[model samples]
Target: MGLNYQLVLWNNHKKTYDKLIVLGMLLYIILFAVVTLVFNSETSIETLVIRAFGSLAIIMLHIILVIGPLARLNSAFLPILYNRRHLGVSMFIAAFIHGGFSMFQFHALGDVNPIYSIFISNMDYGSLTDFPFQVLGFLALLILFVMASTSHDFFLGNLSAKTWKRLHMMVYAAYALIIAHVFLGAFQQETSPFTIGILVFGFILVSSLHLITAFKEGHIDTAKTEEKEGWLKVCDISEIEEDRAKIFTVEKERIAIFKYDGKLSAIHNVCKHQGGPLGEGKIIDGCITCPWHGYQYLPANGQSPPPFTEKVATYELKLDGKTVYINPKAFEEGTEVNPCKI
Candidate 1:
């Protein structure tokens, strides 16, 4: 939420979040190194460092993937979702360290380039046990690097929210590749069944959470309303909580009818910042605040406050006794639609 972009808008919240991330990462790496040394005194420092960072990256990625669905399931997790990009960039750093050391340790002394050697040196793709899994890891790292490089709002603004979101959605692909890399490469060499089982559990957890959240939200997309006099009947006024919203899908567009300050106003459910579900958010300081990033907009006009240029489409709302109805058509972005009195 800024009129102009600098490197970072370091507020107290961001500063605190980043500090926690750094401390957590450092603590994990140190604990990993210490535990590995205590258990396996024969393990070389190089191998230990690579494994520590690689494990950290894997854990960070799991956390990153889980945060979205967790937030969807419960609003208490929204605080964690606020600064996820910082965690993403930090995860990339750990992954880069792991990949860099791995490349050097395994292929640097070869006659050809290390990256080239990763492919040519491991041509046993035909063998499942001896497949070239490093290639998968390298590809995943490349995708992460791309995402990390463009994590800033400058790129988000330039690329447009939709395009930026699509680009970042490549994290799922990267996750799949990393899973293959771990199972085919590291797990093949490891003897511990418990370690492999933990990875399986993580995969199941992430997948199950996403599936559950999606299934829960699926009804909202498929929801249909009765039309009366060119207005779609949304729901009983009692269904909408004060300072909250009830989202309705109209003509393939999701409209959020907010109940605040003893009146009802309808606006596009999609937040301009990152396409977050505004319907999931609450009215804060008389503005509809996005749950994802706290981008605020006036409930009456669907416009961000002064000095902010973001806007969302406003829809007409009407009240018939205790029932709420909304016009199927939407006004232009930033159009002021008078709120329906309760």
Candidate 2:
């Protein structure tokens, strides 16, 4: 929403969200340290800080990963999704602290550079139990640092949304590296069954949530479409929720048919901002809003309001009894078309 670069477009909501996150993170660290002290009185402060921050980072990463799929599964999770960037940046900070402290405690006094030592000191790649797991964590931290550094809208605009999204998608690779780091490092040393069970349960829960969301969307994409001449049947009028859209795949192209104000309109399902799934968003202020970044387009025409040049292809829609149908052929981007009356 800026012509040039912007560090951040902060608002009251973002301030409140950030404050709550910081408070929660501090509380979690304090509680974890207290519990560790009670259980093992001889545990050193450095070890406690390492474990506390490492656990917090992993927990934050899990929350960040789940927010997307959870929001897609239910609209109530949208607020969490909206402020996910903050959570990601916070996670990187926690991880940085853990990494810094570990390096100081274990490798700083050595002859070689600590950063270099992280890689050269751990050469047991052939053995799973003896592998240099610190290297995995270092690489993952590097990726997270990159992502957090370029998380602003300025980066998104300058790098182009497509490139930015692809770069950010490296988080999945980072997550895998972190999982291996934990399993090969901490889990190998921790003998508590409770800790092992929790790790396994978290992995299964995150994996299942992602799989369920993917399958649900896949079913929608594979839905049968009835075509007559140039128009393709979308769905019954009653099936579409008010102010919301029902997405359809017509001839390999995805279209979003929205029912609002007792009328129907169709637009390309992809948002120009980040290729976000526009169909999943709801109508706000009489404009079709994108779920990913809140970009908007008028329903009657696929163009954004003045000062914003974004646009999408508009499709011709028709109503027959209670059924809604859309022309398979899309008009040129920003083309104006009348909304079909319900």
| TM-score of every model versus the real structure | 0.95, 0.91
- Candidate 1 lDDT score at position 11: 88
217-284 per-residue lDDT for model 1 (tens digits): 88988986788989889999999999999988887788889998899999999998888999998999
User: For residues 1-342, could you state the per-residue lDDT of candidate 2 as single tens digits?
Assistant: 545664576789889999988998999999998898899889999999999999899988888898889998997888888888899999999999998899898889999999999989879989999999999999999999999999887787788777988999999999999999999999999868887777778888889999999998898889987888877888889999999999999777789999999989999998877778889988999999998779999998999887888899999999989989888889999999999997
* lDDT against the true structure, each candidate: 0.93, 0.89
Could you say which candidate leads in TM-score? Answer: 1
Candidate 1 error regions (>4 Å): none
In order, how many clashes per candidate? Answer: 0, 0
Q: Could you tell me the C-alpha RMSD of candidate 2 in Å?
A: 2.2
lDDT at 293 for candidate 1?
92
